[model samples]
Target: MKADPKNVLVGSHYLDGNHACAEGAIAAGCKFFGGYPITPSTEIAERVSRRFPLVGGVFVQMEDELASMGAILGAAWGGVKSMTCTSGPGFSLMMENFGLGIMLETPCVLVNVQRGGPSTGLPTLPGQADMMQARWGSHGDYEVIALAPDSPQESFELVIHAFNLSEKYRMPVLVMTDECVGHMTEKVIIPPAEEIELVERNYTDKKPGEAWPYEDTKNLLSPLLPVGKGYKFHVTGLTHDQRGYPIINDEAQEWNVRRLIDKVTKNVDDIVWLEEKDVEGAEIVVMAYGITSRVVQPAIAKAKKDGIKIGMIKMVTVWPFPEKRVKELADKVKALIMVEMNYGQVFLEMDRCVAGKCQTYFVGHAGGTVHNPEDVYKTIKEAVK
Candidate 1:
C-alpha cells in the first residue's frame, strides 16, 4: 500500500525531529493520535493536533499518559492507524496498557522521545537510557520491536517504518528517539505519496460467525476483525483461547504467551535492521545507536587516521537486539566498544553477546550531554591494546 496523497508533504523542508515524526505518521496513514504534552516530545502532539483536522484525522489530548495509551489502543481496534508520543516518565506510565496492547494483539505506534531519567531526571535533555525498558518495562513474557533514529530525517522515515512493523506483526511498535534528535533541526525530504509504501492492517476476510479474534493459525498470527463490523468477539489482558475468552489455566497461559513471543523471535531476520561499515578484518568495532551513532563518528575517523582498524555498527532496530550479527562479529574482531549516553544499558547486551569471545569495553555516563569524541577515541585506543 502507498500513502494517501493528501497526507504527504511531498517536498524538502527544514524540520525538527518531533515535527517530522508527526508528518511521518500522517503520511503512513495514521488517522488517530492520542497524546499528552510532555517535554522534548510535545512538538509531535502539537504538530499532529494542528494538521489532523486538515487531513480529516482525529487528535485527542487525554488526561495523562495512561489514558493516552488507552485511547490509541481503542482507536486502533476501531480500524484506524493510531499512535501516541511521550518521554521517559510517560513511557513508564504506559507500560501496563502497553502489555495489554501486546496481549490483545493491538497494532499501534508509540513514540518515546527519551529524556534523562530514573524519575524525571532531565525532562529537556537527551538520554538513551530507556532502551532496556522498552523491551522489559511491560510485564510478562512477550517480544517487542523498537527503532532508534539518529537524525531528523531518520525520525521522519523510521516512524513510518514503526507503524508498518506494528501492522505487519499485529503488535505495538516503538520509536525510541531522544531529546537531542527530537529537537535537532535538519533537512528532511518528504517523498511523494505514491512512492511511500505502507502495510495495511490485516483485517480478516472470514464471515462474521466464522472468525474468532484470537483464532489459532498456522503462522501464529490471527487476522484482526475491526469492531462494529458485525464481528462479535471479546478481548482482554488475561490468558485467552482462540475465541478470545478468558482461559485461566497453565495450558492457556503457555499457549497464549508463547505465540506472542515466537511471532517476533522466529522472524527476527526479517525485522531487525543494522548498518555496518568497514567491519571486515577490523581489529576493533564500535557499537552505538540513536544520537550516539552520529556522536561516535569523529572518534571513528580519528581512530582510522591513527592507523587503528576500527569498524562501526549502528543499530536501527534496537529491540530483538542483533544477537546473531553481534555474535558473528565477536568471533572476528579483537575487541568491541559500546558507547551511549546512558551508563550501560545496551552495553550489557553487547557484553553478553560477545560471551568472552573477545574483549568488550563500555564508555558511557548517566545522560546529560553527549560523549566527547576524544574520550571515545581514547577508549578505542585502549580497546585495541
Candidate 2:
C-alpha cells in the first residue's frame, strides 16, 4: 500500500460535481463549511450543510456571502479548517473580506463555481471569466492559489489539495470551477479516506498558557490555538508585529509586510502546478487550462499523429501563474498558444512570463461559449509552422 499521502478510509460513491467537491473537502479533514446559496453552486452549499451535520462538522448558511466569507475566516483562525462556496456574484460580494483574509493571513478555501459575469451576466451558465479576478480581486499585494479542474473527480481531489496548500502556505486557496462542471453528472471514484493527505493548522503542543500568541515560528507560520482555548492571540487586518499586535511604524510595517508577502511569493516554485504532454520534443506549445484544456486534447492528438511537434500544458493551479514553466517553454518553443473561455486573461500572464522569448497567441470565446477543437487545431497548426 502507498504510504506517502495517506489513503482515505471512506468508501467511494458516484456523485455530482457539487457533492463530490463536498466529499473531497470532508475527506481533507475540513470540519467547517459556510456559504450563501447561489445557483449552479448552490448544490455545493446544500450538500455540505446536509452532510456536515452527519459527521459532527459545522455548516451554516449566512445571510449573505459577506458573512459566509467572514465566518469561514473566523472559523479558520478559530482552529477549524473551513471553506465557503459561491458563484460569480456571491464571489464578488465576498471580495471585501477576502482582502481581509489576506491581511490577516487567514488559511481557508474559497470555491468559486463561476458563472458568466461582469455583474451576474449569466447565473445558470458557465464561464472561466473569473481567472484573472481570482488572483487580483482583493486589494493590496498578495499571492493566491487558484485551482481549475476539468472534471468532477479532479475537482474533488483538487479541493483537498487547496485546503492543504492553504494551511501549509498560510494563504487563501481559490477553487475555480464553472456552471458546466458544477451541475454536470460524472463518475468520480473516491480514494479511500485513509489515503488522503491532511494538513491541519499548527496549534502549540505546549501547555495551554505556555505558547506565544505569535512568536514568529518557522516559515513565519505562528502557533495557532483555537479561539475558546486559554491561549490569547489577536487577529487583525492591520499590519501586525510578531506578537500579533498592530504595527504602523515604517520599519515595523516593512518587516511585517515583507513576511506576509514572502510567505508565498518567495516560494513560487513549490506552489506552481501543471500537467505537460508531448513537451519533450515540441516546436509549438498550447497553453490551456480548466475545461478549455479538455477541448484542446483532440487537437493535440491529431497534431502528434501527423508528425507535428506540438505540445500541451494543462494548468491545474492557475494562480502563482506557473512562472517557471512558462518562462522555460517560452525560451524553448517556436510559439505559444493560450486558449481559454475569457479574452486574454491567462494570455497576459503568459506574455509577462515570456517577456518576448516567443510569440504568444490568444483565442477566447466568452459568455458561456467556447471555441471548437477545429478552431484550436487550426490555430496550433498555424503556430507550429
Clashes of 2: 14
Cα-lDDT of candidate 2: 0.81
| C-alpha lDDT values of all predictions | 0.94, 0.81
lDDT for model 1 comes to 0.94
- Candidate 2 local lDDT, 1-385, one digit each (tens): 1212222325556677888788778777777888899987998888888777667689998999999999999888877789999999898899889988877777899999988888869888888899888988977777788998888888888998898888887767899988877876788887655567678676678766676555667677666656777766676788778666887888877877777677777677788788998887789889887778888888888888888998889999888788888888888989899998887888899989999989888878775765688888888778876
Q: How far off is residue 226 in model 2, in Å?
A: 3.3
lDDT of 1 by residue, 1-385 (tens): 9999999999999999999999999999899999999998999999999999989899999999999999999999999999999999999999999999999999999999999998989999999999899999998999999999999999999999999999989999999999999999999999999999999899899999999998788777789988998888899898999899999999999999998998899889999999999998899999999999999999999999999999999999989999999999989999999998888988999999999999999999898788899999999999887
Scored by lDDT, the top model is 1
The TM-score of candidate 2 is 0.93
Residue 351's lDDT within candidate 2 is 89
Give TM-scores for every candidate, taking all chains together and pairing residue i with residue i. Answer: 0.99, 0.93
> How high is the lDDT of residue 90 in model 2?
91
